[model samples]
Structures are given as structure tokens and as C-alpha cells.
Target: MEDESGIFARESAYLERYVQLGIASGRVISVSFPAAPEDDAEPDHPLLERVVAYLEGERDDFEDVTVALTVPTAHRTVLEATRAIPYGEQVSVERLARTAGLDADSDDDRNVVRDALASNPAPLLIPDHRVRDGPSAAPPEVEQRLRSLEGL
Candidate 1:
């Protein structure tokens, strides 16, 4: 498991909601901080607990065992990481914010991008389907929300 400190833990409320609702989505798992403290003795947050359990395969029946999607810290941009797609690699606004170093936890900013994507559509040349959650490859809706972030 990666350290949560250096990784700048994204609030990811939608991800929590999706996971709570049993929505399966992929993710880009990266170990940003390898030397951070471990809280394995007791999970502090529900999402943290779920993430730990999921990574350990304790929740196998509830989610997929294979990690199909992943992006390392080495790849600065999602589009840069997904160069193999050839064409139609939609870069969401949220990704832009993350690239520009914005607050990923802000609902208002996230919604702004979502609204822009829903309204304009073409600037988002890459398909939302490509943006995985972490390593598990979350559902389309999760990726859609990610790609819909504002000012990407």
C-alpha cells in the first residue's frame, strides 16, 4: 500500500458514494509516499478501510481482483500516460485542474467542469471511458465524472 501523506489524499466523495453503492470502477494507483506511517491496525475512514480491504483482496466478492488500469506518478498527465490509444483520448477538466494543481476535493470546481463537458462535448476529445479510478478500473460513470471536471 502507498503512503497517503505525499499523495495529497483526494477527498473523492463521489468515489465514496460509488463504492458504497457497489459501483465498480478502475483507478490509477501510484505509491507517492512509500515511507509514510501505516494505519493498518484500524481504518480511520470508511473509504480508507475499503481501499485497504480492496487492495488486500478481502473484498473480492464485491469487486474485481485484477487491476486493469493504473497510472504512476512518473506520468504527469493522464493523456501522456495513455499515448497508446492513438486517438480520442479525452482529457477531462478535473485532470487539467489536477495538472494545474487545483483542489480535487472541491465539489463546485468539479461541477463546473462537469457542466462544461456536458455542454460543449468536443473539447473532451478523449472518451471518458479511459479515465480509470485507481488500479481496479472503476465504472464509466466514475470516469465520466473525472473527465467532467472543470477547467481541464
Candidate 2:
């Protein structure tokens, strides 16, 4: 039987989103990202629900199943920080979530990462952690270089 680990998987398309755009003088800004398609493939990942239920002490049907998530290279600092810690001492998941502006404490985030590790998802396990951190961490010279290369 294939260990569920080390397989590539796509991010869940069922996750919800909220965005706003166009606010003047403290009114607000509204933004429209693409809508998740209704016909998108359903999530087979139950880890999020299971983790929540476990944390809440409401889960009576506990069976081990893995879930997967994708970590984009755009958030590399989190990955590097995570990698710095030995697995036994690693607190990368929470740190990564915080760096990515996601709720690190959320079961959803945790499960997503766990799943990704199990499945060996791309980008999540790729060697591009530097890209993950945002612009503030970029040095002035590097930033100038990146900008110079942008339209080329």
C-alpha cells in the first residue's frame, strides 16, 4: 500500500473568502477575487473537521486519515523559520501561519499543513522559502534588483 505521504495535491476549492474594495476617506475598499466555483471538486479532507472535533472533545469517531495543504513560495520566511527548528522542537506550523497572516491556532490551518506533509504537496515542500516572506524583509538592493527584473 502506498503511504499517503509524498503525493501532490491541490488546495481545497471549497474554502470561503471575504474581500472589500473602494473605500474613500475611511469608507472602505472592495475587492473581487475569483469566486470558488460551485462545481469545483469536493474536499475529501476530513482532517480539519476531525482536528476541530478532537480539540472540542466532540469527536467520537476517530480514525486516522491524512489531509493536505499547499504553502506558496511567497511565504518563505515561515518555511525557513520552520526548517530551522528540529522536528522535535519545531514550532514552524504556527509560526508559518502567523507569517502568512493566517490563524496559526486554527485547526484548519494545522490540518492543512499536516495533510500537505502527508501528501508531499508541491510548493509546500519545494526549495523556495525566501519567496514566501513579504517585501519588508527584502533588502533595498534586492528590492531594486527585483523591480528592475519585473517587466523584463
Q: Over 4 Å off in model 1, which ranges?
A: 1-96, 123-126, 132-152
Give a tens-digit lDDT track for model 1, residues 38-85: 332222434445444533333222122222233333222333323222
RMSD for all candidates, in order, please. Answer: 16.3, 18.3
- Per-residue lDDT of 63 in model 2: 21
lDDT of 2 by residue, 1-152 (tens): 12222211123222222111222232211112123322332223233343234323342322222112234543333433333332112235556566555677998865444443322222111211223232222233432332333211
TM-score per model over all chains: 0.23, 0.23
- Which 10-residue window of candidate 2 scores lowest in summed lDDT? 121-130
Alpha-carbon local distance difference test for all models? 0.33, 0.31
When summed lDDT is taken over every stretch of 10 residues in candidate 1, the lowest stretch is 119-128
Say what the RMSD of model 1 is: 16.3
Which candidate's lDDT is highest? 1
